[model samples]
Target: MNTLFGSNLKYDLKASLVVFLVALPLCLGIAIASGAPPMSGLIAGIVGGIVVGALSGSNVSVSGPAAGLTVIVLDSINSMGTFPLFLATLVIAGLIQLALGIAKAGVIGYYFPHAVIKGMLTAIGLILILKQIPHALGYDVDLMGDQAFLQTDNHNTFSEIWYAIQYYSIGAIPIVLVAMGILILFERPKIKNHKILGVVPGALWAVLSGIIINLAYGVWKPEWQLGGDHLVNIPVLDNLGQIGNLLTFPDFSMIGESTFWIVAATIAIIGSLETLLSIDAADKLDPHKRTTPPSKELVAQGIGNSISGLIGGLPVTAVIVRSSANVASGAKTKMSAVLHGVLLMILVLSIPTILNLIPLSCLAAVLFLVGYKLAKPSIFISIYKNGWDQFIPFIVTVVAILFTDLLVGIGIGMVFGLFFVIKTNFVRSVTLTEMNGNYLLKLQKDVSFLNKALLMKNLSRIPSGSKVIINAQKAQFIDHDIQEVLNDFIASCSDKNISITVEGFKYKIHENI
Candidate 1:
C-alpha cells in the first residue's frame, strides 16, 4: 500500500483540496446552466469523486459533470419532461461506454488529429475570453458563462454580448480593465522575474482582483447590482442539515419519449470523445510515460453515469478542467480525487457558508487559465514539428470542432489521417525467412505493378555471394519487374557459384562458360 500511496499523502490531500475548491462552484454552475436541478452537479461530483475514484485505473483524472454534457442534459430534460426518464438514458449511455471499454476501443482516441485538438483548445479559450467578460465586468443577467454558447439572457452568443454591453456596469468595467492589465503585465517574464508577487498564479491574482472589485462595488454602487450576468448564485446553506435537501430527483415518466434516447446518445458519444481526448492529453503530461487505460475509463464512466442516473445527477466523465487542476496541484494518485470528493461533501454539509465568500468572477479567472493551457502556442508548434501527417488531422480536428460541434470535427480529421496512412503501405513485396538465417523473397499475393520499387530496393540489398531462395508456390501472378530482377540476378550468382533455389516458378538456366 505504501509503495502505491507514496511517503507523503499530504501532497495528495493538498492537491485534492485545491481541486475541490475549484470543483465546488463549477458543479453548481454547470447544473444550473444545464437546466437541471442545481443539486445534480454536486451528486455527480460526489459519485465521480467517491465511486469512480475508487474504481478508476487513472492516477490523476478527476471525474465530474463536464460543460460538454450540458447541451445533452438540457435537451434530454426538455424532451422528456421527466428527469427519471432521462436517468434511464444515462444508464443506457453508461452501459455502452462500459462495453466500449471492455472491447478495448481505447484506440479511438489516437485517431484524433493533433491540429483538431489544438483548434479545440484555442476555440474554447476564445470562448472563455468572451464568456468571462460579463463576470469580469460584473454583469449578472444570466449564468450562461464560459463555452456553452447558448445564452439564457438571450438565445444567441452575440445577443448575450450585446446584453452585457448595453447594461455594462461602470463599477465592473474599470475593475475588469485594471485586473486584465495586471494579468497581462504580470505574465511578462521580465516583470515576473522580480519575484515581487512571489510565484502567484494568474488565477489567484485575478481572483484577488475580483474580491477587491467586489468590495469596491459594495462601497461605490451599493444600491445597484453591477454584476448583471456573471455571478454564481448557488443557494447557501447555514448548517450540515442542508445537504440532505441538495439532491433533486428527475421525473422518470418521460422515459418513453424518443428524445430521451437522443439525449442519452448525445451524452454518451460526446462524453466519450471528451474523456478519450482528455485521457490522451493526461498521458502526454504523465512523468511516468504511462498510457491510461481508456477502456477502463469507459467502464468507470459507465458506472458513474449509471449511479448518477439512479441518484438524480448529470452524466460524468474525466473532465479536463478538473484533471488539469489535479496536475497543477501536484497530485500523484487517484487518492487526490477520492479525497477531493470527500472534502466536497464535508464542505457542502458543514461549511456551506464559507463557499458563499468566493465570487463567480474568481472562478471565471481560473477557467481562463485552464482554457489557455489547452490552447497554448507551444502545443501548436509541437504539432507542426511532428510533420505534415500528424499536422493535417490535428488542424482539421480543431477547425471542425470550432465551426461545428466537438465529435463531428474530430471524425472528419480522423478520416483524413486514416486514408493518408493506409495509402502509404500498399506497395510492398513479402519476405520469408529460412531456418539457416538466410532470407527468401517470396511472392504470395498478386505481383501488381506497385511492387516494382520494393523489388528494386530489396534486390540491391543482396550480398555479392550470398545464397538466396525465391519461392512463389502460392502466387498466381508475377509482374515483369520482379521477374526481370530474378532473371538478371542469376548471371552473377552462377559466376560466383552462389547457391540458389527457385521453387514453384519455372526458370531456364543459362550457361556462360
Candidate 2:
C-alpha cells in the first residue's frame, strides 16, 4: 500500500509535470475546435485526471479531451443549438458509459487485432504531426488539436500545410526549430544518459524557452513578435466568486428531445471505444507491461465525463498522446496521472497567467516529436516483416485513417481482418488422412457454416469401394448447415457401396436424413 503511493515518487512527479505540459495546450485547443468555452477543456482535463484517475485501473494512461471526438462533439453542439443542452448530452453519455462498464462491455477492446491496434496508433501519430504543422509554423488559423482531415476553415490537412508554408512566421520558426531540436536531442542515448540533463525533461525546457523568448520579444524586436493567437489562451479568473459564472449545468428540461439521446449514445459508444483503445495502447507502452482492467476504466471515464458535463466541459476520453507521454516520462503508477490533474487545477486557479505565456508553437513542437516516435520508419519496417496477412490490414488501416475518421478506419480494418480470419478457417476446417483401404476425415475445433463447402468437397474424393470414418470428437461446435451436409452424405453412402462409421455426432440417421 505504501509502495502504491510512494514507489517511484521522483519519476512520477517529474513525469506528471511533463504530461501536464503536454496536456495543457491540447485541452484548450480541443475546446476551441469543439466550439465550446476554452475553460471547458480545462475542466474536463481536471475531472479526467483526478476523478477518472482515481477509479481507473490503468497505471499510466492519462484521460482528457480527445481530438478524435472533436467532429462529433462540434456537430452535436451545433445541432443541439445550445451549450447547456450539449452538457445534458454529456451527462446522459456518462450514464450510458457507466452501464456499459457494469455490463462488462469493455471486453470489446480485447477483440481488436494487434495489426489494427498498431495501425490505429500509427495513424493517430501521423494525424497529430500533420495537424500540428500549422501551429508549429505560426499559422494559427487551424486550431492546434484538430485531427480531422477537413478543417473548420474549409481546408484539408494537406492544404493547411501549404497555407502554413506560404505564411510562415520568422519568430515562430525559431521556437519550433529549437524546441524540436531539443526534444530530438533528449531522445538520444548520450544526452539522456547525462545525469544533469536527464533530470530536466525536454518538454519543460521547450516550454520555458518559449515563454522566455516571447517575453524577450516584448521588450525588444516588437515587430517580430508572436501574436496572442499563437499563445496558450487560458481564461483569467479574477476571484472565487466568478468561478460560478464559468460553470454551466445541464438543462434537464430538454429530456423530451430525441436528438439529445442520439447524441448522448454516440458520445458514449465512441468515447468508450476510444478510451478502451487508448488504454490498450498505453498498456502496450508500459515498461512493466501491467494490464489495465478495461471495465473499471469505463466506469472511471463515466464519472469524469459526468462531472465535466456538470461543469460545462467537453466529453472526456483516455488520450493516447498524453498517455504515451506519461509512459515515456517514466511514470510508474496512476499517481502521475492524478498529479497531472491536480497540477492543471492548481495552475488554472492560481497561476494561469504564467501558463498563458507558453507559445503554441512550442507545444506543437513537443507533439511533433511524440507523433514521430509513434510512427517512425522502424515501426513500418517491423510491420512489413510480419508478412502480407498482417501487413495488408495494418497498411490499409493507416491509409483509411489518414483519409477518413478514426472509427470508420478501424471499422474497415476490422472487416478486412475478419475476411482473413474466415479465409483461414475455411482452409483448415477439415483434415483428410488416407489409411490402408480406408479414408479418415477429422474435424477440428468449432466448425462454422463457411466450412460446409470444403467438407463436401473432401467427402466427394472418397473412393467408391472404400470404407470411411468421420470423426467429430474434437469439434466443439458444428454449424447446422455442416450437420445437414454430413447427414445428406450419410444417407447417400449405401448407394456408393461405402461402409461408413461416425463418431461423436448427436444427429440420428432418420431425423437428420
Candidate 3:
C-alpha cells in the first residue's frame, strides 16, 4: 500500500489540490441550487471522494454531488416537506443502486452509443464555456455549478451573459483577466516543463492570484473590491467539536410510503446512470487508458450515497466535471481522489474562512480551459469526417444537451442514434437490382417489419412484362408484415404481366399468380 501511493505521491498530491479547488465551489453551488444547506454539498463531496473513491476501480474518476441531480434534489425536498425525509429517500436510493450493481446492470452503460457519449462530452464543454461566462464577468445571479439552459434566476444561459455584460463587476474583471492570463501562460511548454513551477498546477496559481488581487483591491481600491456573493461561502466552524452540529440524520419513518420509494428509485436510477456515464468518460480521459468496472463503480456509488445521506448530505454520483479536472491535472491513481476528500474535510472544518476568500471568477477561468479542452474544434472536425451517420447523432446530442438537461438531452440524442441504426439495418437487410429486363430482390439478412416499406417500394418499381426473382436464402427469419407485403406483391404480379420466381423461401407462395 505504501509503495502504491508513495510512487505517485507528488502527482496525486498536486492533482488532489487542483481537484479540491475545483470541487469546493461546485459543492457549495450545487447545494445552494438544490435548496439544501451549503454544508450538505460539502459532506456529499467528502463522502463521494473518500467512500466512493476508495471502493471504485477507477483511478481518475471522482464522485461527488452532481449538478445534474440538483433539480431532482430540489423537487424531492419540497415534496417530502422536510430535508430529513428527503435524506431517507436518498439512503433508499443508494441501497437500490447496490441492488442494481449486484444484478450486473452496470452493462447498461456500455449500451450508450459512442456518438452520444462524444456529444455529451462536447455539450458539457460548451455548457461550461457558456455557463461560466457570467461568472467570469462577475455576474453572480446563477449558481456556480448550474449547467441547465434555463436558470433558477429566470435568465437563460445566454440571457445571463447579456445581463452580465450590462452590469459587469469592475472588481472581478481584473482578477479574472489576471487569473486567466496566468492559467494560459502556465500551459506553455516552457512553464509546464519547469522543474519547480511545474510542480504546481496552473489552476492553483490562478486561484491564489485571484485571492491576492482581490485583497490588493481591498486595500487600495475599496470601491472595486468584491465580496459576499462573488466569492466562495463555506460554513465556518468555531472548532472541531462544532462539526457535529452541521450533520443532519435521515428520517427512516418515511420509507414505508409509496412517494418515498418513488423518490428513492428515481435517485438510484438517475445517479447510477450519471455515475456510469462519468466513469466511462473518465476512463476515456485517463492517460493510461484504464477501464473501470461498471459494476464495482455502481456499488461504490451506492455506498457513497448511503453514507452521505445518513449524515445529511445530498445524493452522490460520479461527476464528470471534477473527474475531467482530475484527469487534466495529471492524476496517476485513485489516491488523488481520496486525498482531495481529506482536504475538503480538513479545510472545511479547519479553515473554511480561508477558502471563502477565493474568488469565483478564478474558478471560472479554470473551468473555461477545461471546457475548451473537452469541446475542442478538432473533436467536431474529426467526428464530421466519420460521415453523416456519426456526425448527425453527435451534433444532435450536443444541441439537445445544450437546450435540455443532461439525461433528457442524451435521451433525445439516443432516439436519433437509434433511428440511424434501424435505418442502416433496413438498408442492409434487403437489396434490389435490375439485370437485363428482370429484377432481383435479395434478402441478405433477417427481414423484420421495419423492412416492409422498403420492400413495397422496390416491388412497386418493377416494370410490366418483366420477370422478377425473390431471394430469401440467407434470411434467417422474416416478419409476418414482410411476408404479407410479399404475398400482396405476388398477387398483383399477374395484372402487371410480371412473372415471379421464388427462391429458398419456406413459406407458401401464390402459385396460381
Candidate 4:
C-alpha cells in the first residue's frame, strides 16, 4: 500500500498541480453554464477529485462538474422552482448510480466499438481546440467549458470563431502566444530532462507568466489589460469561518414530488454513462495500458455525486477533459487526482484572490496543446489505414460529435458501427458455388435471418436440371426464417427439375417434396 502511494510521489505531485490548473476554470465555467452558484462547481470538483479519485479503480481518470450536463441542470433548476430541490434530485441520482454500480451495469461501456471510442477522443480534442480558440482570443461571450456545437449565446461553433476574430482582445493575444510558446518549449528534451526545471509543468509556468504579464500590463498598458470575464472568476470567501455560508444543504421536502424522481433518474443515468465513457477513454490513454474496473468507477462517482449534493454542488462525472489533461501532464497514478482535489480545497479556501489573478487565455493555451495531442493527424491516418470497416464509424463518430452533443453523437456512431458488424456477419455466414450445373450451398456458421436474403438469391440463380447439395456441417444454429426458406425451396425443386441433397442438418429433408 505504501509502495502504491510512494513510488510516484514526485510525478503525481507535479501532475496534480497541472490538473488543478486545468480544472479550476472548468469547474467555474460549467457552474456558470448550468446557472448554479460558482461555489457549487468547486465543491463538485473537490468531491470528484478526493472522493471519487480515492474510491475509483481508475489510475488516471479525473471527475468534476461536466459541461455535458449543463443544459439538463439548467432546465431542471428552472422547472423545479428552486436550487435546493434540484440538490435533492442530485442526492437521489447518486443513490441510483450506486444501485446501478451494484447491478454491474458498467459492462455496457465495453460494448462500444474501438472505432467509436477513438472517435470520441478525437471529437473531444477537436472540441477543445475549436471551443478554446474564442476564450484564448478573449471573446468571453460563451461560458468557458461549453463543448456543444450550438452555444447559449446564439452562435454555433464556427460562427463563434468568426465573431471572436472580429472582437478579439489585443492583450489576450500576447498571453496566448507566450503561454503556447512556453508550453512548446517545455516539451523539449533539454528542459523536460532537466532535474529542477522538469519538476514543474509547462502549464504552471504559462499560468504564472499570464499572471505576471497581466500585472505588468496593469502598470504599463492599462488600455490593453484583461479583467472581468477575461480572468478566472471563482467566488472569494471572506474567511474560512464563513465557509458554511457558501455550502447549501439539499431540501428533502422535494423528495415526495414525482418530478424530483424524474430529475434524479436523468442525472443518474447520464452521469453514469459519461463516467463510463470517460474512464474507458482514460484507460486507452494510459501509458501502462492498465484497465480500470468500470463497476468500481460507477460506485466512486455515485459516492462523489452524493457527497457533492449534500454540500450544495453539481452532479459529478468522470470528465474526459480533466482526465486527458492529467494524462498529458504525466500523471502516474490515482494519487494525482486526489492531490489535485486536496490542492483545490486548500487553495480555494485559503487564497481564492490569488487564483483569480490567473488569466483564462493561458489556460486555454494549455488545453490547446492537450487537444492537439488527442486529435493529431497521425491518429486519423492510423485509423484510416485500418480500412473502411473501421474508418467509416470512426469518421462518422467524429463528425456526429462535432455537429451535435457527445451522447447523441455516440448513439449515432453506435448505429453505424453495429451496421458494419451485421454486414460483415451476413457476408461470412453463407456461401454458394456452382460448377457444371451442380450447385453447393454452405452455411459456414450460425445462420440468422440476416443471411436469408443472400441464401434466397443464391437459390434463385441455380439453373434448371441442376443437382444441388445443401451443407450445414459448420453451422451451429440456423434461424427459423432460414429453415422455412429451405423448406419452400425444396417444395419447388420438382418444377425446376433440380435434385437436392441435404447434409449435416439436424432434421430430415423431405426428399419426395
Candidate 5:
C-alpha cells in the first residue's frame, strides 16, 4: 500500500504542489461565479482531492468543481432560493450517483464516441482561452473557470474579450506578458529536460513572477498598482475554529419538493458523465497508460460530492484541467492528488492571506498553457483527416458547445454520431447470397432495430416460389422488431410456396409452416 504512493514521494510532492497552486484560485473563482460562498469551492476541492483521490481507481485524474457545470450550478442556487437548500440538492445528487454506480450505469461512459469526446475537450479548451482573456488582462469581472458563453455579469464570452481589451488595467499588462513568457520558455525541450530546472513547473514560476512584478509595481509605480480585486481572494482565518464557523450545512427541509429531485438528477447525470469523460481523457494522457475502473470512479465521485454538499460545496467532478496539469507535472500516483487536497485544506486554514496575494492574471496565464495543450491546431487537422463521419461530429460539438452549454453540445454531437451509426448499419444489416436457385439471407453483426424497414424490403424482393434460407449465425443480437418481421414472413411462407430453412437462431420460429 505504501509502495503505491510512498515510492514516488519526491515526484508526487512536486506534482502535488503544482496542482495545489493551480487549484487554489480556481476554487475561489468558481465559488464566486456560482453565487456560493468562496469557501464552498475550497471545500469541494479538498474533498475532491483527499476523499475522491483516495477512493478513486484513477491514478492521474484530479477531481474538483468544474466550470462545465457552472451555469447549471448558478441557476440551481438562484432558483433554489438559498445556499443551504442548494446544498441539499447536491446531497441528493450524490446519492443518485451512488445508485447509478451500483447499477453499473458507468457502462454508458464507454458508449460516447471518441470523436465526440475529443470534440468536447477541444471545445472546453477554446472556452478556457476565451474566458480567461479578461482575467489575464486584469479585468477580473468574470470569475476564473467560468466556461459558459454567458457570464454571471450578463457579458457573454466574446463580449468579455472586447470589454477586456477596452478596459484592461495598464499595470496588469506587463505582469501577464512576463508570466506568459516564463511559461512559454518552460515549454522548451532544453529547459524541460534539465534535471533541476525541469523539476519546477512553469506555473509555479509564473505565479511567483506575477507576485514579484506586482510588488515592484506597488513599490515604484504606486499609481499603476493592482488592487485586491486583481488578486486571489481566499477568506482570512484567524484560527481553526473559524473554519467551522464558515461551513454551511444542508437544509434537509427541501427534500419534499419535486423540483429538488429534478435538480438532483440533473447534477448526478452531468457530474457522472463529466467525471467519466475526464477519467478517460486523463488515462489517455498518462505516460504509463493505466486504465481507471469506471464504476469505482463513479463511486468515489459520489462519496466526495456527498461530503462536499454536506459541508457547503459545489458538485464535484473529475476536472480535465487539473488532471491534465497533474499528468504534465509528472504525478505518479493518487497520493499526489491527496497531498494537493491536504495542502488546500492547510492553506485555507492556515495561510489564506498568503494565497490571497497571488494574482489572478498568473493563474489565467497557467490556464492559457493548459488550454493550448488541449486544443492545439494539429488536433483539428488530425480529426479532419479522419473523414466527415468523424470530423463532422467533432466540429459540430465544438460549435454547439461554444454557442450553448457542455451537455447540450455533447448531445448534439452524439445525435450526429448516432445518425452515422444508423446510416452505416442500414447499408449492411442484411447480406445476400445465392446457392443455385435458393436465396439466402444472412444477418451480419448486431442488426439494430433501425434496419427493420430495410430488412423487410429485402425479404419482399425474394422471388416467390424460390427456396429461402435465413442465417443468424454471425449475428450477436437480432433486434426484437426485426425478429417479429422474420416471424411474420415465415408464417406466410407456405402460402407463397416458398419453403424456408433457418440456421443458428437461438429462438424457435413461431407459427412455422
Candidate 6:
C-alpha cells in the first residue's frame, strides 16, 4: 500500500487541500439545490470526507452529497416532513448496501452494458449543462438552484433555460466569460511554467474572478443584480460558541412514519448507485487498475450517512467529481480524502469568513468542466469503435436516460443487452468429417427454437450437391421448429441431386418422430 500507487505525505497533503477547495461549494450548492437546509450539504461533505474517508478502502474515491441524489433528497424532505425519520431510513439503506456488498454483488456492475454507462454519462452531462445555464446566466428564480429538472412548480429543464434567457443579466455574463478563460488557460501545459499560478487551480482562479466581478458590479452598476439569493449565504457562526446554533438535529417524533422509510430507501438506492458507479470509474482511473472493494465501500458509506443523518446533515455517497479531482490532483491513497474532510470541518467551523468569501458562480464553473468531461466526444467515439453489440446497448442507454432518468435508462439498456446475448446463443452447430469432398454437421444437445435461425443460415451458406451429413449424437428436447429446418434441408438436397446422410439421431419418446 505504501509503494507504487501510494504517495508521500507531501503530495497527499497538497492533493487533499486542492480537493477540499474543489468540494466545499459543491457540497453547499448541491445541498441548497436539493431543497434541504444548506448546512445539510456541508455536514454530509464533512462526514463523507472524514469519517467515511478513513473507513473506505478506496484510494481515490471521495464520498459526499452528490448532485445525482439532489432530486431524491428534495422530494423526500418535502414528502416526509420529519427529517429525523429519514435518518433512520439512511441506516436501513446502508444496511442494504452493505448486504449487497457482502453477498458479492459487485459483479452486478459487469452485467451493465458499456453503451448504457456511456449513455448515462452523456445524459447526465446534458442535464448538468441544462441545469447550470440559469445560474451561469444570472437568473434569480427563487428555487433556481434546486436539483429537480422541472422544479416543484413543474418547470422542466428546458423551461428553466428559456426563463434564464428571458431574464439574462449583463453582470452574470462577464463572470462566465472569465470562468471560460480560466478553464482554457489552466488546461494548457505551458501555464505550468508561470511559477506563481501553476500550482493553484483553475477553479480557485475562476471563483476569485467571479467574486471580483460581482464586487465590481456592486460598486459601479449597483443594479448589476449580483446579490439577492444568487449567492451562497450560509449563516456564518463565530467559532465553537455558535457552531451548535448552525447545526440542526432530526425530529425524533417522525420515526414511526412509514413515509420516512420510503424516503430513506430512495436516498439509499440512489446514493448507492451513484457511489458504485463512481467507484467503478475510480478503478478505471487507477494507474495500477486496483478495484475498490465495493462491499467495504458500502460499509463506509453507511457509517458516514448514519453519522451525518444523526448530526443534521444530508445523505452521503461517493461523488464522482471529487473522486476525479482527487485522482487528477495526484491523490494516491484514502489519506487525501480523509485530510480533505478534516480541512472542510476546520474551514467551515473555524474559518467561516474565508468560506463565505468564495463565490457561487466560481463553483458553477468547476461543475461546467466536470459535466463536459463526463460527456466528452472522445467517450462516444470509443463506444462507437467497440461496434454495434456495444454501440446498440450504449445508444439505448443514452436514449433511455435522455427520455427518462438514470435508473430507468440503465434498466432499458440492460433488458435489450440481455436480449442481444440470448439472440447470439440461438444457433447450434454439428461438425463433420470430410467424405467425398463434402462435410457433415453433428447436431446434438437440447435443440430448441433457438437453433432455427442458425440452422437456416448454415443450410443456405453451403453449396448445393455438396455431400452433407447430419450427426445428432445427443438430440434431446428437439423442438418442431428445428425439425422443420432439417426437413427442408433434406428436401432441398434431393432437388439439387446432392447426396445427404443422417446418423445418431434417435426418437426415444415421441411417437410422431
Name the candidate, 2 or 4, with the larger TM-score value: 4
**Best by the TM-score measure:** 4
Task: Write down the RMSD of all candidates, one decimal each.
Answer: 7.4, 2.5, 2.7, 2.1, 3.6, 4.7
Residue 499, model 1: Cα distance from true site in angstroms: 19
Backbone clash numbers for all candidates listed: 24, 0, 0, 0, 0, 4
The CA lDDT at 461 in model 2 is 89
For residues 1-513, write the lDDT of model 4, one tens digit per residue: 788767788888988998999899999989988999999999999999999999999999999999889999999999788899899899889989998998999999899889999999999999999999998998988888789999987679999999999999989999999999999999998998799999888889999999999999999999889999999987887778898998999988978888999999999998999899889999999999999999888888988899999999999999999999899988999999999999999999998999999989999999999899999999999999999999999999999999998998989999999999888889888888888878899998899998888999988898889999999999999999999999999999889898998999987556563
Q: Which one wins by lDDT: 1 or 3?
A: 3
On residues 10-76, what C-alpha lDDT tens digit does candidate 6 reach at each position? Answer: 5567568767866776787777777777788888888999999998989888888886677777677
After superposition, the stretches of candidate 3 with alpha carbons farther than 4 Å from their true spots are 1-7, 433-440, 460-474, 484-513
Q: Candidates ranked by lDDT, best first?
A: 4, 3, 2, 5, 6, 1
Badly placed stretches (over 4 Å) of model 6 are 1-22, 140-148, 193-196, 248-266, 285-288, 328-330, 424-449, 456-513
Tens-digit per-residue lDDT, 75-172, candidate 5? 99887899999999999899889888888888777888888888888887888788788988989887776777877778799998999999998888
Q: Relative to the true structure, how large is the alpha-carbon lDDT of every model?
A: 0.69, 0.87, 0.91, 0.92, 0.86, 0.72
RMSD of 4: 2.1
lDDT assessment of candidate 4: 0.92
The local lDDT score (0 to 100) that residue 257 gets in candidate 5 is 88
- Which stretches of model 2 miss by more than 4 angstroms? 193-195, 218-221, 433-439, 462-468, 488-501, 508-513
User: How accurate locally is residue 65 in candidate 1, as Cα lDDT from 0 to 100?
Assistant: 88
List model 2 lDDT by residue over 35-150, tens digit each.
Answer: 89988998899998999988999999999999889989999999788899999999999999999999899998998888888898899889889988888889888777777777
TM-score of decoy 3: 0.92
Off by over 4 Å in 5: 1-7, 431-442, 452-472, 476-513
Best by lDDT: 4
